[model samples]
Target: MATAYISTPLGSAKLEGDENGLNTVTVLEQDEPESKIIPDVLIDAAYQLNEYFEGKRQNFDLLLNPEGTEFQKKVWSLLSEIPYGKTLSYLELSRRLGDVKAIRAVASANGKNPLWIIIPCHRVIGSDGSLTGYAGGLHRKKWLLNHESPSRQQSLF
Candidate 1:
């Protein structure tokens, strides 16, 4: 596995992956030094992430190889399909997965998502539209959601 670190508005991010595909992109609570030499396999991932933070990119287009159970993978797969700037409730996600009764299971899998912004776990919210738990923390989740929010214009005086 190869590793690289990059700084974001929220915090420093650590990316881990190799030839098979990118595995994980995790944001750390504490700032870390950026990688001086990013691995070739992760170069694109780093670049794309930078573009995302810059608001120049909306969707990611790279091969991913996250490690998780079949159900978790399925949940992550659906997460990627959620359009940028949109949110989905946990119950809605469970319904899409064909089992409203699996809301907890769906949420568990969502919480376990390893790809961070790439898999878009931050897009999932509570049924009441509240920002819920995030592996990177709720603050970062709020930052991500706001970053992805469509630009709004204010009335000129």
Candidate 2:
């Protein structure tokens, strides 16, 4: 697997992938050195992520190959269908998955999402529109949501 680290507005991001596809994209809590030379296979992902942070890109078009169980993969796939600047509730996600009773399982699978922003696990919020669990921490989740918010706040100079 090829690995590359890049800097973002939130923090350092670690990307791993190869010829098959991108395996994961995660923001590291601890600071890590950015790669001076990104692997060829990961170059697109790195550049897209940089564009996302810079507000130049909204949709991702890189191949992904996240590792997970069948159910987790299903959940992640559904997450990717969520539109940019939109949020979905766990209950709604469960319903979409065809089993509202599987909310917990759905939430568990959402928590295990490996692609980070690319899969858009951050777009899943509480039924009450509250920001809930995020492996990258709620602060990062909030930042991501605000970054994707349709209404951008303008600053007066």
Candidate 3:
């Protein structure tokens, strides 16, 4: 698989993929000298991601092959259904999956999502509308939510 470092508003990210499809998009604190070469698949992903960050693209159009178990795949699939500028609680996600008892499992799978914003995992929040666990950090999660919301903006003062 080929890989390359991609810089984003959240931070630097490592994108990996091949002709089969994009495999992973991981956040990195520093650039790794040994990172794989950027392949065409990943290049397209990066361009799409740039458009997403700039609010020009609401939906992605790239091949994705996130690795996970069947149950995790199911959870990720449900997460993708969450519309832009909206949020879902872990309990709600569990219920949607037709297994309320899987709340914890659902949250676990959410944390393990490899696609980040592309998979829309950040749309999941606490039941009381509070921000919750996000692998990329809560601040980034808040930033993402705000970015998707039309009413949010930084104050000049």
Candidate 4:
């Protein structure tokens, strides 16, 4: 798999994929020295991600191939349909999957989402309107949500 790293507001993001499709986009602790130069395969993913971070793009259009179980794939598929700037509770996501009893499983798959902002697992939240779990840390999650919010903070004099 070809890998490319880009510095994001949250941290350094590692983009992994190849001819099959873009696989994963995970945040790192800090900006690390990139090992490989951006490959031809990863250019679009990098550009789209850069646009996303800049708030100039809200959606992504690229081939994706996230490795996961059948059930996990189903959960991730549904996650991609979630509109930008909108939040879905874990319980609601479970219900959408046709089994509220599977809340825990759904949340677990959401947590394991590999595509990061592209698939938008950060859009998932606690049922109690709280920022719950995130692989990239809660602070980053908050920043992402705020970034997508239509209610941009405007300075009025």
All candidates: TM-score:
0.95, 0.96, 0.91, 0.94
Residue clash pairs of candidate 1: none
- List model 1 lDDT by residue over 37-153, tens digit each: 999999999999999999999999998999999999999999999999899999999999999999999989998998989999999998888989888888888888888887524
Candidate 1 vs. true structure, TM-score: 0.95
Model 3: how far residue 61 lies from native, Å: 1.3
The digit string of per-residue lDDT tens for model 3 on 113-140 reads: 9987889999999998889999998888
lDDT value for model 3 = 0.86
Candidate 3 segments exceeding 4 Å error: 31-37, 154-157
lDDT order, best first, reads 2, 1, 4, 3
Model 2 global lDDT (CA atoms, 0 to 1): 0.92
Tens digits of lDDT, candidate 2, 93-134 = 999999999999999999888898999999999999888999
* Cα distance off (Å), candidate 3, residue 62: 1.4
Reference-based lDDT, each prediction: 0.91, 0.92, 0.86, 0.89
Candidate ordering by TM-score (highest first): 2, 1, 4, 3
Predicted structure 4: clash tally: 0
> Which candidate wins on TM-score?
2
C-alpha positional error of residue 80 in candidate 4 after TM-score superposition, expressed in Å: 0.5
Instruction: Give the lDDT of residue 23 in candidate 4.
Output: 91
Q: Candidate 4 on 11-58: residue-level lDDT in tens?
A: 789999999999999999878766456998899999998899888999
